[model samples]
Target: MANLRDPVIGPVIRAEGLTKVYRSGPVEVQALRGVDFTAAAGEFVVILGPSGSGKSTFLNILGGLDTASAGRVWFRGLDLTALDDRGLTRYRRDHVGFVFQFYNLVPSLTALENVALVTEIARNPMPPAEALALVGLSARRDHFPAQLSGGEQQRVAIARAIAKRPELLFCDEPTGALDSATGIKVLEALTEVNRATGATTLVITHNAAIREIADRSLRFADGRIAEEVVNPVRKAPTEVSW
Candidate 1:
């Protein structure tokens, strides 16, 4: 593992010769095939791909939700592929935040308490109130999940994910469930959080409109990165449209 404190000397995330395979009964499926990837610190990256393009699988491997059958992943200097199950769990809990398509907020808890759930156990987390404020949800802190719109609920989820100030933020199909107008707000929240926290952020989405907000954009196909492009200018999320 590299010294994580070292400032952008190398890739914040690096993966080499990665592969993932799933086996069930007599069926075997490959999700990623010989893929290599690198992400710099504080970079906002977006992965664009169709269904079954392996984007989520790659994000999962990076975020410690799933293991790669082959290859190695380096987070700063830690070898994720080499970590045992317990190590991966600790790594995820300590250094990574994830937002999915669904809000997944505890329906019983108010937005504030939902975010507080993670901050309470995090090593050096900001106050739950602060996290909520970051996503422009300070006024909704006491609202239950059912009382909020899809966009608001998603922002709450983002607040929870980032409350710990993790080094990485992984979002899988983050806007898939929202309408166009609501989705824009979610993306704006994500972009704002990325800029404010300087966390290396990666979002997976099928929508091409979201690509404008990324510093780097990747197209995935058949379990591999088909094309990668760097943006000289990043468009604000507010400018993106369906």
Candidate 2:
């Protein structure tokens, strides 16, 4: 494992020959197939694919939520594939943040409190209120998850993920559960957070329209990256359609 302070000369994240397999008795499934990938510092990347094309698997491996069966992954020059479970946990806690499709906020906690939960344990967290404000949720900070709209709840979840000031942010199907109008709102929040924090952000989604907001777009097929596009000019979330 490389030291945390070691300067990374190239990509903030790099992966080579990454692979993953899941087994169940006589059944075997390959989720990722020798994928090579990289992301520069503060890059906002969007990944698109049909279900089971390996997008989520790739994101999980890079974010330390899952390990690759073969090959290596590096973040800021630190070898992720070499870390044990405990080390991976620390890596996630200290350097990575994640938002999933579901707004997994505590039903009993207010939006502010839910965001505060992450800040309480973070090494260098921003104020919880400020995190909420980033997502345009400060006005509803006192509202419980049950009281907020779907988009608002998801924004709160984004606030929670970013509160820790992570070096990387991974969002998987973050707008999947919302309607078009609401999903656009959530996307706006995500784009704003990416711009404000400058975190190396990866958003995996089935919606291709979301790609317009990304600096780079990747398409996956049959457990491989099928195409890559560099959007010369990224459009604002409001300019995108579902």
Reference-based lDDT, each prediction:
0.93, 0.93
Runs off by more than 4 Å, candidate 2: 1-8
lDDT assessment of candidate 1: 0.93
lDDT of 2 by residue, 30-66 (tens): 9998999999888999999999999999999999999
For every candidate in turn, the CA RMSD to the true structure comes to: 1.2, 1.4
Cα deviation of 129, candidate 1, in Å: 0.8
| Candidate 2 pairs with clashing backbones | none
- Pairs that clash in candidate 1: 1-77, 2-77
Candidate 2 matches the true fold with a TM-score of 0.97
Candidate 1, residues 156-239, lDDT tens digits: the string is 999999999998999998899999989999999999999999899999999988888999999999999999999999998888
Model 2: which ten-residue window has the lowest total lDDT? 1-10
